[model samples]
Target: TPLRKWEDVERTVSLAAKELPVTDMHTHLFSADFKEQLLWGVDELLIYHYLTAEYFRYSELSYDDFWKYSKQQQAELIWQELFVKRSPVSEAASGVLTAFRRLGLDTSSRDINIYREAWKNRTASEQIDKVLAAARVKEVVMTNDPLDRSEREVWLHQGNTDTRFLGALRIDALLLNWTVASAELAAMGYQVEGEWNDGVSGEVRRFLKEWSAKVGALYIAASLPGDVRFGGRDHLTAMLEEAVIPVCLELGLPLGLMIGVRRQVNPSLKLAGDMSMKADLQLLEAVAVSHPDLQLLITVLARENQHELTVLSRKFRNITLFGCWWFLHTESMIQELTRFRTELLGFSYIPQHSDCRVLEQLINKWEHSRTVISEVLVSKYKRVYESGWLLSEEDIVRDLNEWFGGRFAVVRQNAAKTKVR
Candidate 1:
């Protein structure tokens, strides 16, 4: 079933990349059961953190006054400034246009009300299904934080009801904000103090165990700032070593680390205020070696970290590099990273994860991503084909699937098979 010509390679790779059903390995999406937590609609798309950050870049509106507006009002200003006053040329702005077109909504109207009216009759579930299907997203993993009172309330009270949603236990609080963490843990009936103790460790382990099962979490994750060092001087190191690592090791869950985020550089920007700094990639060297059996999936926000991160993944068998996160999620970065990842790592690394907060944003994110990635694939395939290699449609599809989510599954499977210690 080998394809003979360059034309076939171009044609088949494009279609396969576009049509393949992918798993979003990391997203903020909730099930329809969580109600408004499952973000969608044109308003949510317009007011996305990316667009909001860009909106404030040029808008004369003061931060306090802008925060005073309703979500719809904010979305309206964003639409007018980003879409009307200027061209919707920024990635996030153009993504709004892309999502609209993919959903079969009228982007040509340039009218926010038209998009809003189109969403009036649709249920969250309907919109989720349409969005996922449009993106060819088969499944999505959610960031579930037990220390978050609202999320924990939903988890403990009603729990997630949607079949498509899976969970990853987010331990940002456990890693960084132990004050709030211990208070939340205490309320959940786990007796722990402001410090990590034997009893406290046991309690924390118990919490992780119960909640991981409660939410069907596939892994444990935390977002750490650039200064956080894995084996060196850092406050979170002890908690990670004593609590998070052991629990993850015992439960056969891969530890997901999203590093290099420097939070609240501009408090006025809220979620958009955070920025990236070059993390000491050497920090991971010790942890990756010490816990050789445990799976470590990492993504960094700094562009400077990409080369070192990929190089370090080369040194360790257990490390799996994934995603072009945050500021690095643009199309150009995706292409650049995809090129090197393929050249150096071959197909071992995951090319991208939507990191999508809005459910409907999946449509445009993947729509744009597929186009960018497939272009890389076409060139790579041609080079290999010229080198006397021929690929069939099945081969291309399988490769695309692996880059999308199959590789992450293999990592998860390896961790699952690890004898929990």
Candidate 2:
């Protein structure tokens, strides 16, 4: 039914969008398995990799010299150089203030130690709950790396029991950089000598199966470079065709590809210095064309690729476009991308993903994104209502719920049924 009035549509959509519980589709955050790996506090917030890149523009400190400082020292330096000495005007800098304000801390204090003292009382789990409550996050999808020794040890010994932290198997090393990943696999007692072949493919499948079953993974994911192509005779493509895709199909899970990351553009800044390039959508097109049965959760880092990717999603039923990732997570970009996606694909696309490496970041990231999402929805609904469409409150709720997490929940439930059979 169509919404009776424009005021009713605006109020309904705005309320539904703001209050909806988000199942964050992709994040680099950790579970309690490696509690130390769970980053929080004002210092961690101030020294985020995004801010690190910005720090370079204003600081006299060389990258090599800055790298030598301890974590606490680096945080202090960033607070002084970027926050106190200059205006915290950029999006990354403003985010730290946002988190602080959300936590009921006084942002007026230039003293870093005072803010640190404020965070000293809460336990990690308690802080996680606080952040989630503030962000209205229902579930957080973690990037579980099986090759990482600390994370692997947790799985081997205790196993993850937390329902809130959903697992996603990150297979970038195995799929894209097998030489390094194979060595890590060999150390874990899986046999693989030289190039990829039948035996290695079997081992890769076994690894994915064991971990996926152990962690109850919602999906298998990887980040690929701009040059990544399908239909090649190369071993990487061979591994994808033979092992990765087959394992995903067998397990009845979606494959998540975060495309166009140009890793380590500045070796000194490490992960923070990572950049993006425009990836060939033709490769994605080839993959979708080749594996029509396979479901894909795709998010590209480059803004230029957004339209083409959405167009591709329109063409292929299997591909679902998700999130404005990393550099593209700005308000302007989110507004542009969300409007473009909504107009072109309707509610078929996911509007946002947290991608937060630290827990408290969930506050600012989701806060900023939800505002953009709601604004976009309001505009779209206004147009529809003007044309005499009667959208009920139930209609708005259902669409908002599905866009947030209901669809992913359905995918997970279907995968579980497949596993049982």
- lDDT comparing candidate 2 with the true structure: 0.85
lDDT of 2 by residue, 265-325 (tens): 8888887879999998777898889987778889998988998999999999788888899
**C-alpha-based local distance difference test score of model 1:** 0.87
The number of the candidate with the highest lDDT is 1
How do the residues 324-377 of candidate 1 rate in per-residue lDDT, one tens digit apiece? 898888989989988887878888988888889998888888888888889998
Pick the TM-score winner.
1
For every model shown, the clashing-pair count is 0, 7
Give Cα distance to truth, residue 222, candidate 2, Å: 0.5
lDDT value, residue 335 of candidate 1 = 90
